[model samples]
Each structure stands twice: as C-alpha cells, then as structure tokens.
Target chain A: MIITKKSYTFEVSPQSVDFNCQITLSSLTDLLLTAAQYNAEENGFGLRKLNNNGLSWVLLRLALEIDYFPLQYETVYIETWIEGVGRASTTRNFCIRNKEMQIIGYAASTWAMIDHQTRRAQDLFTLDNIGDFASEETVPIDKPIKLSERRGVLTDVFSAKYSHIDINRHVNTMRYVEWISNGFSPEHYSRKSVKRFDVNFMSEILFGEEVKVYKTEEAGDTYLFEILHNDKPSCRARLIFRSEK
Target chain B: MIITKKSYTFEVSPQSVDFNCQITLSSLTDLLLTAAQYNAEENGFGLRKLNNNGLSWVLLRLALEIDYFPLQYETVYIETWIEGVGRASTTRNFCIRNKEMQIIGYAASTWAMIDHQTRRAQDLFTLDNIGDFASEETVPIDKPIKLSERRGVLTDVFSAKYSHIDINRHVNTMRYVEWISNGFSPEHYSRKSVKRFDVNFMSEILFGEEVKVYKTEEAGDTYLFEILHNDKPSCRARLIFRSEK
Candidate 1:
C-alpha cells in the first residue's frame, strides 16, 4: 500500500524571518504548501501529473493556527496527509513540530481539481486511486471556514505582474495570502500573534490584471479582507489574533 | 583549517516557479541568500550569532547572470564562498549548476556588517578571523556595477508593510528586488530572459514608509531603476536582458 502520510523537515532560514527574527506567516504558509505538494507528488497524484492530463489543482480554503512562531535557524518538520476526498474537493491536514518533536502549529486546507481548458471544477474522485490515500484524520483545529463575500474599505490597489504568476499561469496562492497579511501594521504583529487564519480563494488573478484589496475590522480582533481583480472578487480571508502583551 | 566554501542543493518547488514552471529571479536570489547565511553560520559568523552582539549582515549590491533558469522539480546546486573581505564590505560569489553538474548561472554580491543599534557599517575585519575564509577568487560574469543616480519614470508606488520588513527591522533586500523585478510585465519576460542583474541598496525603508520605483531605459537593452522611500533615494539597479526568441 502506498504511504498516505508524509513528513518533510525544514530549517527556518534567514530569508523566511521577519523583523522579529521569527518566521513570517507567508513563509510558514509556503512551508505548508510545499509539504502539501510534496505529499501529493509522493502519492503520484501531484500537480505535474495532473497537468499532463489537462487538469489542475486550486486551493479553495485554508486555516492555520500556531502556538508560537519559530525563530530563525530553527528546524521544524511538517507532516501532512489527505484527510478526506470527495467528488469535488479534498481536505489536507498538517502538523507542525519543532526540532524536539513538540507540536507547534497545525493547518488544514481544501482543494479542488479543475479542467485546464474550461476552468471548471472536475470530479476529484475520478483521479485513479486518489481516494486510496485518504487517512480520514484531521489536525487539531477548526476546519477552514467559507468566508463571506465582503466589499470593505479599499486599502491597496495594484496589478498582477510577472512576479505574481506561478506555474499554473495565474497569481500564486501565497501571494494572495501575502496581500491579506499585509493589511495589518507591524504594531499589530508586536502586540498580537495570529491565533487563527482562514482564507478562501474564489478566482484567479492573472498577469497584468489590476487588483484591489479591501480590508474591514469586523470586531476587536478579527479582520476580514477581499481581493478584487479588475473589480471582480478573487479571494477573501479572516484573521483572528490573540494578545501577546 | 575550516572549509570556507560551501554548496547546497535544492529542488525547485512549485512555490518558487513562475508561470513558465521556471524558477523566478526573486526565488533564485532567496536561494543564494540562504546559501550565504548557511555558510556564514557554518563558519561561526552567522546572523544568529551576530544578533547576540547586536550586529547583522546586509546585502549592498548583487549581480546574477543565468544561462537558463531551472524548471520546477529540477534539482540545482549553489556553491558560495567569500571572495574577499575589506573593512566595510565583503565580496561573495556563487556558482549555480543543474543536477548533471552543468554550470547554469553565476552570481556576485557585496555585503557589509552593521551594528543593529546604530545601523552603521562596521569594520568587517573586527569579526574574529573572518578574513580567513576569503578565497580571493572571482566569477566569470561582470561584477555588480555601482549604478549612477537617475530620476527616471515613476513605475510603482506602495507602502512598506509589516510583511516587507525582515529580521533587521527594515525592508528586506529580497522584497526590494521583487519590486524592481515586478516593474516589467509578463510580455517582457516572454520575449526576453535576464542575462545580468545589478542592484545597490543605498538606504533602508522601514515599515509604513511609502516607496516609489523609477525606471530608465538606456541605449541598448540595459534598464536602470531608482527606488525612493518618501522621496529619498533608497535603492538602484540595472537589468540587462537577452532576447530569448
């Protein structure tokens, strides 16, 4: 039987750290996404193989919670596995641990496979034996929520450029996370660390396309974001923070 | 004697690739910077150790020339070593090769050690025996040129957010590199591939600070860039591209 669960180890390099010498959220997300891709490839159902079949995977939603962010040069491991697979989507869960094997964070994400030409969802279960790898286990956290559509205060406006597009020919998922994460200030980070983050990608932002990021404070500690491409919604997210001081 | 030269291998992951499935320049620069930090730490002058003394390393100028960019999932190696160390700056060089060990690219960079508190350049020789690692060698490519000041066309404007700042409490070098690289559209990349890139960081841009990027096309294929932070020149760069068609 093919191994469904896979683990990858990584060191928090200097390039991943932020002003506090701790790993930035975007880099952490990168690590998680990397682990997901690696595990999918190990199972022989990765993006490369799917691309050959004229199909592509798109992230639908993601949620992450960290106990404490790791510092620069610290080694960490990420173990990920498919929790469940349905006709339209699949759930992948991750466990993040420090060098000592102590759990530090967890993440859960949902993905959908789509037809490359139609840009429409394809039945994910149709992939031969992809369901065989489902472990039916989940991380110790709330599932990624489906964020509501919001048209908040326009905070940032820009165009997707060459640097923004990824292998799938659209803006990378991590760049969307970055745009949402950037809505807050350094002071907010110093005073509070993200306890939970939920993001939903609705559409793809393409190269040379204009983008507008809207931000709204829904509560004392919860913030919501909507990213619009050419005035059309592309992604939405919510971040929950806990006071550190 | 401790080994001064070091090499690290990396598999180009999905997160690092662009629309063409080839590694992006920013990600490539990240790999080079990662190698520099790893080698420095291996030699006992790493940032973690420097942080204890309120000191840190900063890139001053860098120039990279790639024969062909590696594609996603391709294994590549980067070997780096200190070319020389002076009072205020040090020269480091890199060689990039594919899995078959064929040389594909070369990069040369200049860096300085600065007191984190005062933010002033320090005599690099003051570090214990750091000069011992200087190989006094040079790469085959042209050195990172010292670009002259230019008031070109304003290309991009944005505020440096928390995500832009690195462990040094200011905007990170790679972020600045991305901004400069983002100035050109995808059509430009589709037609031309970078032959050489040179960047000089003149001043630091802190969080919440607004920045403006300017571009000037000189005679031939050379393009010059000037990055201003709140109307003050912060960085400058030159990119030379070769027609791929």
Candidate 2:
C-alpha cells in the first residue's frame, strides 16, 4: 500500500527550549504528534473534529534514533508516512530535518483508533468510515538501534522521584533526557548548543524505580550509554554533545 | 516579613494544550518559572545571566491548585510571590485568575540555588553578592489534600501499562484524569465537557502499578471517586460533567 508521505516543518523557538537551553522531550513528543495529526488530516481527519463515528486516535508506542538535534531558531522538518496496519496497531514514521535538509533524526510510532463508546480498539480500515486511507508509501517498521555494548563518557544513576516525574505512569521521556543530560557536570544547559539522543524502553520504570546509567565515549564525539534496570537494559542511546565544556 | 507579591499574566491558547486537550504540566511549570524569574529580576539579579559565574536557580517542589481551566482565547492572569526562604529552599505561591478576577487556581513551589561549579544545593540567602529579590507575603506550604470517604457509582481496576506512564515515571496526571473518565462504562473517551474535578494525590503510583477505583454519584450529577493504591488513596477526586452532549 502506498501511504501518502506527509511532512511538517517547524523552526526551533526559544520558548520551546528548556532551562538547559535545549528543546525538551515534551516538545519533541508534540512535534511528533503534530506531524502525525497532519498526515491524519491529509488522509481525511484532523484534530479539530472527531471522526464520522465520533472516535479518535491515541498513541501507543514510539521508537526512534536521533543523530543530532537542531539548535534554537534552526528550522526542522518532520516527514511522516503510514506503514500499514499490523493486527490491531497502525505504524507511522518520521524524519527530523534541519534548515539545510540534513536528516538529524528519525522515528517510528504506533497508534490505535479507539471506539469512543466501547473503549476498545477500533478497526483502522473502518475507523473513519471512509475506507482505508490509501497510502503511497507503506513502509516497514524502523530497524531499532543495537543497544548492546553501551558506553559513554558520563554515566549516572537516578531514581524516579515525585518531583521529577509526570502524569504518565512511565518516566516522562523528556524528563529522562533532562535528568540524564543534567547528570553531566558540563555547562550546556544554559548555552546555545546541539544535541543528539536516542533511548528505548525495555523494562517498565515506575515511581521510585532506581536505575543506573552507563556511559562511554563513542565515535564523532558522541557519548553512548544504556539505562540499566537492575543491570538489564531498560533504554540505550547515544547522545552527541556539541560542547562538552 | 512582608514579601513583595509579584504578578504576570498569559493568554491561554490552543497550542498550549497537548493532544489530550489539557493545559500541559509543562505549561504550568513554565508559568511558575516565569513568575519566579520576574521576582528574581525585580530583585536586581538577572536570573538568566549571573555574570557568567553560573550560580543558578533550580526547581524543587511544586503544589498547584487548579479549580477550573480557562477556555480557548481566554486571558488568564498569574500572580506569584516568594512566600519564604529556608536554609536550602525558597518557597513561592501562584494564584491564577480569569478576566473576572476570580481565583481559578493556585500553586506553591520551592526553589533551590546552586553554585554552577559545585552542582550542590546552597543556602537560600547565603550569597552576599546576591541581589534583592523580596516578597511581601511570607506564608507556609499549603497543606496537601488528604483523601476521605466517598459514595460508590463506578468501580474500575486499571493496570498502569508502559505506555500509560510519563517521564516522571508515574501515571501522567492528565492521563489519570483521562483514564478515570475512560472508566465510565457509559461514556468512552468522547466526553464533550468536563465540568469540575478536584483530584488529590495521596500515594505515588508507578509503572506497572494497578489501581482499583471506586466512584460515587454525588449531588447534581457530580461523581466522586478515589484511585486506590493497596486500598489507600493514590488520587481522589470529584468530577462534574458540564458538557451537554
């Protein structure tokens, strides 16, 4: 199936950045959702209204690999496509770009159309009653990063605390990034900088779950590490720091 | 000690709400920071630029009281002040309002000052070089709400799945609201209106945590319930539905 590949572009803004002076994970999630909504609208649905059946789409899972992050005021684009339905879930892909069109990051996610009355997963093909929104580019799930051999220059252990947590039952992805970067004694949080980070969830981290982070130097001045859940891999990623000072 | 009460206002916009149609937790955090920063700057200290010495202010704890959320295109005002300063923390309070000047919500938070080189918490008023940030209202922390008895109208056992969590590593607050609403068998995720809700978090819920919910029908179509953790209160709230769908 050829799913229409739709894309969205946004410029990095100061308000979107964090105290660390970097775009936050929450913002990234918004970016992904915004892009997905764009594709959904192009296919005959948008956020402004419910479907013909009064149902709405909800997120399920997200996986990604980030090579680098665009700095503040740098224009970034997100290209998205539907990857066909698999059993109950539908997959989508996104590519992050800079003003120069460099691919800074890429991601894939899955969502379920839920029935508003039944509170159950609704069949995506019949979701909008418009038949299957044909796609021009039905892609496969993205190849996940090999999380083995995790190493980085800075590794720290953190436990989920009431203050650092969010409304989600899991560690907010952006907060994890913020905490991990903060583990660094570096001075980038307040500076204009560039960053690249990727993390995958393995074991569910709950409130008060203590986890250790392992970091080792990687190629291209990137630091790679794995968030270990009781010595097992919870999430692994490589973060490229523009300035380590 | 009369602490000077400082204030600022921001208009609520659609973009401020996330996919869930709620003013995000981060928006609240940013609002708190804005109020605090204003007071700091008025105290003659540039919170952003500390002469490159790197001493910075960090958030510690925050308690917000939101009785009602403003609708789209509404102008909301936020008034804040440093309630007091302890050895390691400074407490601040935020009062929210609509154009009518009715108190819609309030939040209290603690901030800690840290030396950039040490990355350790420092005494709140120890910096001799620190500028004048003063407040007129020196108050104590608002006593957190405690859960109590309620009537029973609905019962739900919800498992905290991986996707149901956020970075704070617990159930996302808004998602909890969403899910509790989801628990309504007669209504799925299609409620057009949420009249009023008061949720008090008792115990922290984590990833993979399962909650047993009990609801009661209150007077005038309001529903009261408590999310229980091991039979104790994790979150308790009364929801009034205002949307006439």
Best by TM-score: 1
CAPRI level of candidate 2: incorrect
Query: What's the i-RMS of each model?
Result: 1.1, 11.3
Candidate No. with top DockQ: 1
Native contacts matched by each model: 0.94, 0.00
Please give, for residues A69-182, the per-residue lDDT of candidate 1 as tens digits. Answer: 898889989999999899999999999999899998999999999998899999987899988888888787999998888888999999898788887789998788788889
Candidate 2 chain B lDDT trough over 10 residues, lowest sum: B183-192
List candidate 2 segments past 4 Å from native.
Answer: A1-20, A24-30, A33-83, A95-146, A149-154, A163-168, A179-183, A187-196, A220-222, A230-232, A240-245, B1-27, B35-95, B98-102, B106-245
lDDT of 1 at B27: 85
Query: Model 1's CAPRI class?
Result: high
Supply the TM-score of chain A against the true chain A for every candidate structure. 0.96, 0.58
lDDT (10s digit) by residue, model 2, range A173-231: 55555445544432333332434445555554555577776777666666666676556
